[model samples]
Target chain A: MDALVIGTIIKVVLVLLIVSALAGFGTYIERKVLAFMQRRLGPTHVGPFGLLQIAADGIKLFTKEDIIPQHANKFIFSLAPVITAATAFIALSAVPLFPTFVIPESLPLIGGAIVPSVIADVNIGILFVLGMMAAGLYGPLLAGMAQANKWGILGSARTAVQFLSYEVVTGLSVLAPIMLVGSLSLIDFNSAQAGGIGSWIIWQQPVAFVLFLIAGFAETNRTPFDLLEHEAEIISGYVTEYSGLRWGMFFIGEYSNMFTVSILAAVIFCGGYGDLGFIPGSLALLLKVVFFFFLMLWVRASWPHIRPDQLMWLCWKVLMPLAVVNIVITGIVVMI
Target chain B: MFEQIAFYLFSFLTIGLFLVTVFSNNILYAMTSLAAGMVLIAGFFFLNGADFLGVVQIIVYVGAVMALYAFGMMFFNVTKVVKEKNTSNLLVLFLGVSIALLMVIMFLSPIVPEAIFASVPPEPNATNPEAVGMVLFSKYLVPFEVSAVMLLIAMIGGIILAGKKMDQSLTKIEDEIISEKDVK
Candidate 1:
């Protein structure tokens, strides 16, 4: 096989394996964090400090029976989970998790191979990632509509509004940073912030950073904004009709999206994969992502989900306006 | 070689999906297919090396616009939304869009494939979003600004429509509360 093809294949497999595992591990992290916050030992029996719990859950989800509603559109019902899972994974292709590295020529099959951190280094990297994540709304939307259940439809409806409204905030808030960086590529965003702690875009675009973080939670359907799957009101919303592994796919997709959002926040606002003092680029990037992930869990544990009306009200009346103002200010700053 | 194969595959899927989007009996399924088809067109842009345009297409069309369509669908009864396919308007749209799509595809596809096999690959700017930005802000600046203005107008129009709807709903809710008070 050609070297380019081989390199691309390697990146694809690496992204798929590492990200899927991270998604599962995210559940473990969430449980552990929420547990700690509430003063409880979370899943101590599963594995050493419950590190292997993700594996256990994975097995359970996989082995569980796949149930289909009799009235559901069989093809679409089955396709929904795959779409969520697939799109979640696809979005990661543009995200630069680590810095690029080149292999030494001593390698046998592959010699002097340069492997970029990203699977696809498309120019419009951030936009592609946002697009893929937004497209993720369809998974739950379709799943709910196809399930032939009222709760499913309600869940999907909420999903649509939640994803759509937050999307404007996400794009507008991120626009400031993109304008500052002058490139849509995530790698460019990272490089533009290469000057240590103080050089991070967050320091400059503080409002955009905060707005993007809040909007990120809504986009990922995280707590305080997780109206799409709010258990108390909507009865698990879009997943009301989902079960077993099918339901697990949504979980995985959500977690993966969380990771994607965290990565975006870290890269666009915080210093991205750039090295900080002694820390290597990749490790620094991972640390930023880990911090963001923990923040999501912390918010989830402490905050209550908002009402649907409030959710929309916040999006349009507050967040969107804030984002637009931020963008305009950013444009002026860039021009000057 | 891989690019050619991908182009053919994506084009084929886009055409097939358009057919599915129009012909499907389930409005839910049809809308979903339409979203997928739009994304597949983005695939063509990606294949042609217009990465910026491709991502923009997905962001604007699939992400924002289609989600609006899906949300609109949510308010309607699913059974009622799926209109009978025999309508002349539907037929006209299907025929017109398909023909236009095919014509564009044919014109865009490599002319005399062998004679111009891989002639100066379509998009050199694929790796440079900044280049696209430069061109847009320089050469196409006026049109771009005009489009932004148009979008602002559209936003105002949407707000007006939504505001009227809200007023109607609010009055209805007020009527219900008043009736309950009388009963009490």
Candidate 2:
């Protein structure tokens, strides 16, 4: 096989294994973080500092029964979680996870292949990532609609509204940075800010950064914009009827998406994979991603989720217009 | 060799998905198949090296347009079989045949002489999106702005049509009904 093909396969496998494991680990982190915030010990009985709680949960989920509701559309119900997980991973293909590394020539059959940080690295990397994430909306939407439960229907309706509304903001907000960089590739975005912290796009386009972050929260179905699956309003929303590995797939997809958004934010605004002073490129990027991930957990612990109507209002009446204005301002600045 | 395999595989999958879209009795099946077909159509654009167009195809068609279609499909009973009342089979056949013929002619037109082909050949060094932008902003500016205006008008019309009872809130209406009952 060709070196390029082998490298890509390796990258894909690595991304799949690492990201899914990280996603499972994320649940454990969230529990611990939330527990500390609420002043309690979380899952201490399971393992040391509850580190092995992820394994325990994984085993429980794997052993749990897979149940399909009697009236549900079985095909779609089964396909939904797969779509969620698949699109999440698909979106990651274009993302430059870390600095590219080459294996030593003496290693093995797959040796000497330089594995690029991104798997696909298409010209329109940012758009491709956004499109895949957008496609991920169908997972929950289809799952809810196919389930034949009223709560599921309500959840899917909210999913449609939330995803569609925020997508506009996401696109428009990101457009300012794209305009400034003059390229849609995230690698280019990283390189554009390679001069140092001062050259970061966030300094010039803070509004876009903030808007993108907000929309990113909504896109990932994080706390403030988690109307799609708000337990208080709609019993687990789209995942109400789901159980076992099927439900685990949705959980994995959500956490994977959270990572994608964090990595994107780091790369786009915070000088992704670019060196900061003495910090190496890879370590810098890792720090940024970790901070963003921690920020999400922090926000989840601190703030309250909004109502469905309020979410729509914020998206259309507030965020969308602000994104458009930011784009206009960015265009004017670029023109000058 | 890889391109040939990919092209053939995508073509087969696209056709199969579209066929499911057309012939499926269940609405959910039809909608899901249609969305999948749209994604496969994007694969065609990618195969042609139009990366920008492919991403836009996925973002606009599969991500937005088909999503909206699915949203509308949710109002219907998805599991229930859809029964079409074919009042005139001959008419259906005639329409389908003509549309297919028209599409064939359309596809063939660019191959023939003086059939209004590419006004601007793609620049060698530029990316797909840059080339598209250059052509769109320079040559096709008027038509693009005109379409945008038309879309804006359509959007306003839709808002007006849908928001006829904009002032009346459901909660307020419920309150009014309760007050009237108390008064009575």
Candidate 3:
């Protein structure tokens, strides 16, 4: 009993630490990418390679004055960022970092340790991730509504609609992979991609992979789908009233979500940490993650934000139909 | 023992969130509460024997359906005031409570044999993935196909709703633009 309790605690801490680091780096990468695309230098002043930029920003946010609009619901405003960051962190628990690297000493620290890669390894890991992602929207939605600002409300509404549309595509696209693998556990999904490069599910289900990527980008509120924060219209959207650490949490949550989606894309399509039998195990996983991170940065730099109606149309009309077809095809192929 | 405690805790949370969902005045709050309830229900499903069902419930209902409902609320310009409680439905609330009680009684009466519960099922061989595939294709093919059709219908319905509204708004704008052009 003691062992299990300690183990779970360690797992929770580990997850938080990893998520924070990823979120920080994600911010740095986004700024660099955006600057490069616009032909300008990005945050080069903070530290070497601007590596400490996020850290400096974090410190600044923490030290800055927290001002609440007199009319805002203080309780809900405070709760929003907590809910957002918490949900993002919770979703990462089910994602396996490496197939065998479970929380160290989580199971008694004995020799020949069971390298459990995930926190829970629940049977319905995919579902859990999706649920958390849905729950995650409350942060922005509540912040918008509670702030009693028109811009906040508009941003909140746009975000709500955008997420709803993409979520369908995300779920359906995931179904194609789930149907092929016949298991919902991330571990099971990763292991099934065991053979050489050809065995990767991405090659087998390219359409599903593409749909998943597009839907993931939309789900994370990345560029080409970020009408919620269109400066010309809603002016910073849901976080308009937030300042200091409170606002920082929202940005951190966004970056963490970017990492989460990228990691998920890697796991579902890029043979998740699999070395293709050439590179070593842990290194292979790291490479995959880095590769995905770059892909996300590349896409961010290249695409312009789509209009709100166009975004919805693309999700419902284009991605949804394609995802359904992918599922049908995967089911047939798997059966054969 | 720990599992039992965790199960009860999550079950209570699920019920509490469900109550919040029904009682909350704000539509967005109600949807958020519903999402929480769905997640806790997924926990309940995990505690019970239905692993896949639990996951699907979270993915489908919480992830997709509830999200869509929240989006609908936002798109339709629903505010907290719009979701205010209807005081005219006392009898309906009574009926709802009674129906819920009836369902609890109806479903909780069956007890699985103790012998089955006492023994953990041996871990099936990894090859069972193939067996699952075979069974799904051969036995569950009809339901599988039906689910596909159902999803297709839902997709088409959403598209019609969103698309039609968008086109109407666009045409209205186009008409104004054309009128201005003629005047110019």
Q: Which ten residues in a row have the lowest lDDT in candidate 2 chain A?
A: A108-117
Model 3 regions lying over 4 Å from their true place: A2-5, A101-111, B22-31, B63-172, B175-184
Which one is best on TM-score? Answer: 2
lDDT of 2 by residue, B1-184 (tens): 9999999999999989999988988888888888888988999899989999999999888656546655565567776787877899899999999989999998899787787866688999999899999988998999999999999999899889978976554544577787897899
The CAPRI-style docking tier of model 3 reads acceptable
Superposed model 2: Cα runs more than 4 Å off: A104-113, B70-74, B103-119, B163-174, B177-184
lDDT of 3 at A87: 84
Model 1: chain A TM-score against the true structure = 0.97
Residues B75-179 of candidate 3 have per-residue lDDT tens digits of: 644343453445768888998999999999767756544424523342355333344456667777999899999989997898688566564545347787878
Q: True interface contacts reproduced by each model, as a fraction?
A: 0.54, 0.51, 0.27
Each model's DockQ score:
0.48, 0.56, 0.28
TM-score of each: 0.89, 0.94, 0.82
Model 2 clashing residue pairs (backbone):
none
Expressed as tens digits, the lDDT of each residue in A1-336 for candidate 2 is 776787778779988999999999999999998999999988898878889989999999999999999999999999999999999999999999998787799998758877688899898999999999999989998999899888898888888888767888999999999999999999899999999999999999999999999999999999988998999989999999999999999999999999999999999998999888999999999999999999999999999999877777788889988989998888998999
Candidate 1 local lDDT, A237-313, one digit each (tens): 87887888999988889889999999999989888888889999999989999999999999999998888777777
For model 2 chain B, the run of ten residues with the poorest summed lDDT: B62-71
lDDT of 3 by residue, A1-336 (tens): 676567767878977887787777778887887798889889898789788998998889899999888877676778889888888888888887776754456445554445577777776677678767777877887788778788988887787778778887888888888887878777778888877578888888888888888887777777778766777778989888899989988877877777778778888887887766768666777787777777877876887777787887788778888888888877777889
The lowest-lDDT stretch of 10 consecutive residues in candidate 3 chain A is: A102-111
Displacement of the residue A146 alpha carbon in candidate 2, Å: 1.3
